[model samples]
Target: MPRQLLTDELWEKLKIIMLKMGIYDKPCLRKTVEGIFYRLRVGCPWRDLPTAFGNWNAVYKRFNDWSRKEKLMGIFNALVVDPDLEWEFIDGSIVKAHQHNSGAACEQETAIGKSVAGNTSKIHMAVDACGLPIHFSVTGGEVHDCKEAPKLVAELPKGDYIVADRGYDSEALRLQIKDKGAVPVIPRKKNSTRGNDEMDWCLYKYRHLVENVFARLKHFRAIATRYDKLKRNFEGSIALACGLLWLPM
Candidate 1:
């Protein structure tokens, strides 16, 4: 059998969530789910999946269907229970896009963009004080962090502080965070007249939490490299990876 990524304990928990989400149990459900996990963990072409998990096409179809229905995202969200709200950290990371992701019928919707590093996509993410992903969005790599900040900030739960790196420094964004009832702990750029005197250097050190979450998610090879031709599919992969982090909880 292909290396199993989900333990019996984790699968049990996931099964309850799936059933609750209306994904009915089937004799092959576990194997199908395992097939999906294997692809995500191994980062292999769908057709390359081992027969131990059943037909590769069937597994891919189910994944695509779940992704389209947003069921996978629902599973991820459902797993997020009470998250630490003391602080919310936001950041973006670029994923190198494989050539296989090209040739989409609607190229513009692919969420692929050219950057200094060549073709790439960016994962804009928000994590709670515990460094667990709470929200995220995918964009073309060329999209600026500040450009996606407003949407992420708008969706963030009210928290004590919203922290980000200097790349996210902006007066407007700071005001937005203030409007959300959270202090913006973003440092100002050197060229800015307003200095970072009020910045919480101590709290800023914890910004690494969000970076750490990104590092952990990328350990899933599917997340480390972008292969999905559609943005929704890619986002589904991200949601699954994020949900996996919360599985132990």
Candidate 2:
């Protein structure tokens, strides 16, 4: 059997939220859920799931049903606690798309895009002051972090301050964040004459928290690599990982 991911206490909490979200727990739901976690953490093909977890196809089919119906993301959303609003951080990271992730005949869409890095996808994420993920979006790996900042921050629960690295330094993005009533603490570009304007070096140092958040999420092999051809499947995988993160907090 694969090692456990969620503790009994955590499972209890998750079970309640899932019930409230319409996933009515089944007799074997816990085992079924753990099967998904095993695959996500091990980054194994669905067909390779251990026999102790029951038929791999059933688990895979259940995962697909939930992912296709948005139920997985729904469970993740329902599990989130009210996040701290003191400081918010945003950043992006690229994951190489495994060659096996390709070749769907009916492939209608993909977050994957070609770049010097080859096939890849980008994960744009926002974390609260405590390094808990608040929200995230997936885009083509080649997409610039600055270009996606405005959209990622637009709907976030308002925070007193928004902090990011130089990759997000843009006058337009700064103004957009300001208009939302959150002070922007982005560093200026090297070429820019304006130095540290409204920049809080003290709070900026904590920006590593968001990076730490990514590090933790990426510990789950499924999130560290892009093996799912469909964008929704990748997203649902991320959502499940995020939901588990919230459980421990």
Candidate 3:
């Protein structure tokens, strides 16, 4: 059974968007997308996806191509209104790197550090109040959360509030956020040279929204377990999951 997250009318509208975006041309595109979403919803591996939908490789390939092209970002951007555009949260989560996700010869270029878990990847995401992701970056798990703050904040709209944990407290990150006309709401570190930074405990409490987004994203087993061998494909799955998050309830 097709677990319908979209109504028939909405599905038709989505198909039109895909057609206009040239995503409907591939004979297997629809089936591939369906199968991928099925796996996401059911928390199954690509190869474990039911064969009735189509070849797992084909679906994975399409997903990778779209992700590289930023099609998923476009699709997600088109679906949701940018609410609280000035309020965003920054957070990082460590994913246990599966052997299947290894063997990327190119990853050496981006490998910065390793986590206590040994082989792992860190996903840094910036999300709006609606729990919609605005920007994301990946790095070695050992990378400091504060190191990616600048990059993540760079993608946010100007003059926004970026809420983060003490891990993101740093003079460089604060200046970067200020350069972008955004407020840095990171709590002060215990051993910091400067005294406690100004914090909005009330608004900071809402920082958990980004954590909730991470929780929802990890709900997809592939994301949690990471069966995709390619980093691009894994990122694509994250974008696709974000698109699903935009669906009307």
Candidate 4:
């Protein structure tokens, strides 16, 4: 059997959330969840799940059911902290989609899109000052970072400052962030006719923290490369990874 990803300490945290969410009544909840993580960690097809975790079909069905019902995201949110509202950083990353993971029925609504990388998807996210993710949205890779900035900032739990790279430099976005009562720390574009946005260079240095969060999350194979055909499944994968990041803290 393969090594388990759900250690006893981690299981203690996960089990409580799952139980509260009514994940399943069966006794082997640990194995089932570990099975799901195994697929995410290794980026393998569900049918390849090791027998020690249980039948692959049953494990896949349980995950599918949860993903469809948005229970996985619920589990992630249940364990997340009430994020610090002082400073927030936002950014986006593109992941190449595996061809095998494409072509599902109703897949048109998925975040997959044609980009320079061929088939790809994007994970747009925001992180608190501590560099922990507070909210995220997945979109087609071809979508520009500026296009998604509004949605991410709009959903943020009221913060004092919002930071991002030049990719997010836009007058409208800055005004939107200001409307939320948060100062926008995004840099101004060189050629733009608009005057300076009065950025705080010192605080903007922390924008890399959000990038760091994405880097850690991509260490989980499922997130580094898009292996799921459905958008919700990919969302669930990200949620699980994010929740685990909080489980130990």
Candidate 5:
């Protein structure tokens, strides 16, 4: 049997969520979820899944159905019952897209872009005070962090402060955060004359929390490197990884 990622304890918690999603009562559902987790962990082709998990095609179809309906995302959000809102951090990371990511029917929506790193996708994310992922969005690699910030900021729950790196230095964004009743703890760019005199460096230091969440999620091979051709599937993989982070809480 292939190495399983879900412990009985984790499965017990996840099973309740799955049951509520109406997918857990089906035959071999646990194995099917294990099969999906295996693919996310090992980054293998669906057809290459170990037979111990059952027929590979059946597993892939089940994952695809869930991805299309965004059940995985629902599961992730459902797990995030309450999050620390004292401070929040936002950041972006690029994931190298494998050659196998090619040939998607809708290339434009695949969130892949040609950059110095070749094909890539970018993840814009926000984490709560405890460094747990609260929300995130995916975009093409070449997309700027600020370009995706507004949507992410809007989705994030209100907090006392929102921290980010200089890549997100923008007067407009600062105002948006202020409008949302949170202080924007971003440093001014080196070229900016206004300076960071009033910037909360202490709170800003915690920005690493967002980066830490990214690092943890990237431990899942399917997340560190994109294997899913479609954007939704890739997001589903990320959602599952993020949801697992909240399972222990």
Candidate 6:
């Protein structure tokens, strides 16, 4: 697929951000840095990086160095546009882990998790109405979506309306959400016999927005399948993808 280059204005903004983050101090040139980010945003393999950006090895080295320093996540967090409203959606999506992501094989116990698809990693995400990601967490696919709810919601600003699904239904989860001063709009499971609690079906429909956000995230093929061996790089790519999503299209 053909890729879009950053506009001059956006490129200038990126340069400013990189300079502030001390990424421009190295031997890496402007073209190299831009190429690295381009491949990241486009979700293409490093070897497939367009020649216009500069040597692919140079771009990949810069990317790896930045990943190690956690600079990418910093840039992402700094660039994210804050949500204009006080409502958010929370959900988790499973990404199949690739063999290449097994560099930390010794730490396999830490990275591998069970999912419906067998072994996979789970990404817990919370996004605002505009589909801007606010907070995220990673765990083994075996972990229940509801298990990641508290941590995801904890990062959200207090008093926001958090919409979820029936899978998130649980008294403890509801209490945690309420404790944060946010209303839990998750529907009750069918097996629930509780008569006092009720769900707003109208609000439930909007929960699909989170699903849409996941769909956009997976549009980046790199994120669709894990390639980065380290958990941090894997997660950094996610944050980068989120940053691109927040950018004005």
Instruction: Give me candidate 1's TM-score against the actual structure.
Output: 0.98
Candidate 5 lDDT trough over 10 residues, lowest sum: 106-115
User: Which regions of candidate 5 are displaced past 4 Å?
Assistant: none
Among these predicted structures, which one has the highest lDDT?
Answer: 1
**Which digits, one per residue and each the tens of the lDDT, describe model 2 over residues 1-249?**
668788899889888887776776788888988999999998999888998788999998888878888888888777668899889999999998999899855755678898789999999999998899889999999999998888999968899999999999899998998898989999998898988766789999998998898898899898899888888889989999988888877
lDDT of 4 by residue, 1-249 (tens): 787777788888788889788876687778888899999899988888899999999899889889898998999888877778799989999999998886789734688999999999999988888888888999999999999988888888899998899899888998999899988898888887775656688898888899899999998998999989899999999999998888887
Preferred candidate (lDDT higher): 1 or 2: 1
Pick out the ten consecutive residues of candidate 4 with the lowest summed lDDT. Answer: 191-200
What's the lDDT for candidate 3? 0.74
Q: lDDT tens string, model 3, 1-249?
A: 556355666666667666666675667656777887887677666677777678887876777778777677677766655556668888999888766666666743333346798777778988887778777877778888987777778777764787899899888998888888877788888877776647778879999999998898888777776656656666777777876776652
**RMSD of every prediction:** 1.1, 1.3, 2.6, 1.4, 1.1, 2.8
TM-scores, all models, native as reference:
0.98, 0.96, 0.87, 0.96, 0.97, 0.87
Alpha-carbon lDDT, every model: 0.93, 0.88, 0.74, 0.88, 0.92, 0.75
* Model 6 TM-score, all chains together: 0.87
- Global CA lDDT computed for model 1: 0.93
Clashing pairs in 4: none
Q: What C-alpha lDDT, on a 0 to 100 scale, does residue 157 get in candidate 3?
A: 73
CA lDDT of 150 in candidate 2? 85
lDDT of 4: 0.88
Pairs that collide in candidate 6 are 114-141, 114-142
**What tens digits encode model 5's per-residue C-alpha lDDT throughout 167-196?**
999999999999999999999999999998
Report the backbone clash tally of model 2. Answer: 0
- Point out the higher-scoring one by lDDT: 4 or 6: 4
Task: Output the worst ten-in-a-row residue range by lDDT, candidate 1.
Answer: 102-111
User: How many residue pairs clash in model 3?
Assistant: 0
